[model samples]
Target: MASSSAGIVTGLVAAAFVTIGVLAHQASVTAPADLGPAHATVSPAPGAVKAPRDRRHPDALPAGSGTGERVVYSVDDDRVWLVGPGNKVRHTFAVTPGSVDPAPGAYTVTSRSSRITGSDGVLVEHVVRFTSAGGVAVGFSAAVDDAAAKPDPDRPTGGIRESRADGDAMWEFATIGRPVVVVR
Candidate 1:
């Protein structure tokens, strides 16, 4: 009888471990709530309309923006997400894109200027440049006068304008060599 009792105890312990393992696996495979059905849809055909943003969580970091510390800029949404370790979104904000948009791809911060005259002739601060399009240097900046208006369409410009506070955050987060992911 004691032997039978020991066997039953061992069986229960084994079952518990199996159950725990299954649960952990499920959790690891499951997408984060904000990601929504994204990982599976990362590589849609070229020129395919990008997935619609989650209306419920518009500020959620876009899916397929890659993992780890990086900046994600969505051209369609005209928004930026500062992603940190563990794929968490540290901050997100709307931006005003210029006439040229960077092609959807990964890039690293190539340079930054604390204060400079933007291509559009706006006195800007915290200029964080990552890529260029059509000879225009693409970057994020805030106008010294706090202007965040749309850029003039006639001129080719690449400044993705942000608010002063947002520019400060970008300046601090996007150091040189930090990954910047552009998505449609």
Candidate 2:
């Protein structure tokens, strides 16, 4: 009887191991492919409407008091917006929320850069970096609560290198050198 019991236990342990191995194999077999590289050619479904225009602007006050703030920006649905005081809009151009995927939500501007000219005369423009606060939703049910610039430990630079880091994920955006004005 003792030998029989030991054999049963051994059989059960072996079965458990086999089951785990099968599950692992199945998981590996069913794993999805990385589709990021091939996503460029994919087009949106027919009749699917794009997201509404971003009307948000920076928080800067209008040039003249009581004149209703005028926001400068270029309209690009692909980018995010920072709504200024009196509903003035400022286009950050390239900076977008880290959580933006298939569908993105509103993001608030966390930092801004002053106008800077590049040595190439290309006019390296100012950038407005933003992070996801609450109430902003996006695709894949992901959201960002905070973001900051990536600090280079090797070289301590003065200007903040804009970056978005939500937990382990991070993203960066380049600023376009154009401004448009909108009155609220």
List the lowest-lDDT window of 10 residues for candidate 2.
Answer: 34-43
Q: Candidate 2, which segments miss by more than 4 Å at Cα?
A: 1-49, 52-103, 115-123, 132-184
lDDT of 1 by residue, 53-161 (tens): 7789888877667778989988889999999989888999999988888777677899999999988899999999987777778899999999766689899888999
What is candidate 2's local distance difference test score? 0.30
Error (Å) of candidate 2 at residue 35 is: 29
Question: Lowest summed-lDDT stretch of 10 residues in model 1?
Answer: 35-44
lDDT of 2 by residue, 124-156 (tens): 224343322232221100112223333243432
Q: Per model, state how many residue pairs clash.
A: 0, 12
> Stretches of candidate 1 above 4 Å error?
1-52
Q: Return the TM-score for candidate 2, rounded to 2 decimals.
A: 0.21
